[model samples]
Target chain A: MNDKKIKNVFIEGAISSEFIGRSIAKHQTKTSIGAHNIFLGQVRADEVDEKTIYAIEYTAYKDMANAKFHDIREATFKKFDLTCMHIYHSLGTVKVGEICLFVFVSSPRRKQVFKALEYVVEEIKAKVPVYGKEIFEDASHQWKVNS
Target chain B: MNLNIKYFGLLTEVTLCSEETVPFSKATVSELLDLLFEKHPDLKNKDFQVALNNEIVSKDTLITANELALLPPFSGG
Candidate 1:
């Protein structure tokens, strides 16, 4: 939580399972963490006007998005008793059923991880200056709005 | 004053460009928006907020920074 570096939270494409597994494996050195919670956001193949979504193309105002992510990380640490946390969001094309967002939070106790993980995800959904273009199967697209 | 104006999300589609340097003599965010509306009339109907130097600000806030961004509703996770 004391880490103040402005970590880049963006990945060029979908987050792979192997990358996630590696992240977890690297945390073994920190035996102080008693509980870990994770949240993965997948691209849903939603239908609109009879057309199904095939993928989403993501973009962001990099400077502002990173700043917002940093603020959210700092705020979450202040609000929760978390041992560590990591967040990653996808940029560019992400196919349906692929992972676009990943949040990992660890704490010394079970309850803190549960609360901190949800808080971080909700804050990212509300505050980050990132955009998604939902591309339909017919190659048409529409801007995504978070409900 | 000359300012760096950035368009994001749907705003970029409306403007047909992502970022541009615009010269403005305005003192407030609302006044600056008026100038943009004249150039891109379609933007007047779009739902968005203005960020002055990376912070969301009210329309009446004084223009103190040389950078501004038009941000539509965020859909990030």
Candidate 2:
């Protein structure tokens, strides 16, 4: 696929449902694939010692985040021979139980699609420069990232 | 000379500010980090990553003037 095939690249204040739905639809058209696997990451309320995580406030260094996302997209294409891939991540603040990241990958067969989707998601989590602030119910917070 | 640096996630909290400028001579990224750590030793043990002009770089990478330095770890989808 051409570079233009990757659309809706953003590290914005927030990611809307419309944007995610459109991304999924865009992949369906690009690939005549029978199967597609999508991974949506949601913020959960967790008890951290004495504090409980009520929500996550996501913040990105915009210029850096965009550059990282672009690099990941190019790398995914080179690593996996697939129909298409689209990645969207939240920027400002995402509350508990809310969606923060949506990764969509499509291919002709279910096996390839599943594997590719997992790889992309794992890479994004490990390499991308996004940060999450876990806010406690009592008003304290902690930054959340992959260990 | 002065260089603008940006901090993210936990680094931001420790520094108490998202961005700041540090006066220094020509130095590598590692050198700059050493100066920063000298001022804020709390960052010495934290898990963080650095970027020079939007690309990830090792701690030993040299940094030039006017480059935006960012310290943030991966948190994408």
Name the best candidate (by DockQ): 1
TM-score of each: 0.97, 0.85
True contacts kept of 2: 0.92
Instruction: Indicate which candidate wins on TM-score.
Output: 1
Candidate 2 ranges with C-alpha deviation above 4 Å:
A1-8, A11-18, A26-31, B70-72
For candidate 2, write residues A19-106 as lDDT tens digits. Answer: 7787767664564777888888888787889788987777777676666667777877787777777777877677777788888877
The deviation in Å at residue A128 for candidate 2 is 0.9
Docking class of 2: medium
lDDT of 2 by residue, B1-77 (tens): 88888888788878888988888778788888889999888888887777877778887777874665566566654
Stretches of candidate 1 off by over 4 Å are: A1-3
Estimate, for each residue in A7-81, the C-alpha lDDT of model 1 and write its tens digit: 899999999999999999989999999999999999999999999999999999888899899999999989999
Residue B45 of model 1, lDDT score: 98
Tell me how each candidate scores on DockQ against the true complex: 0.87, 0.76
Which pairs clash (backbone N, Cα, C closer than 3 Å) in model 2?
A: none
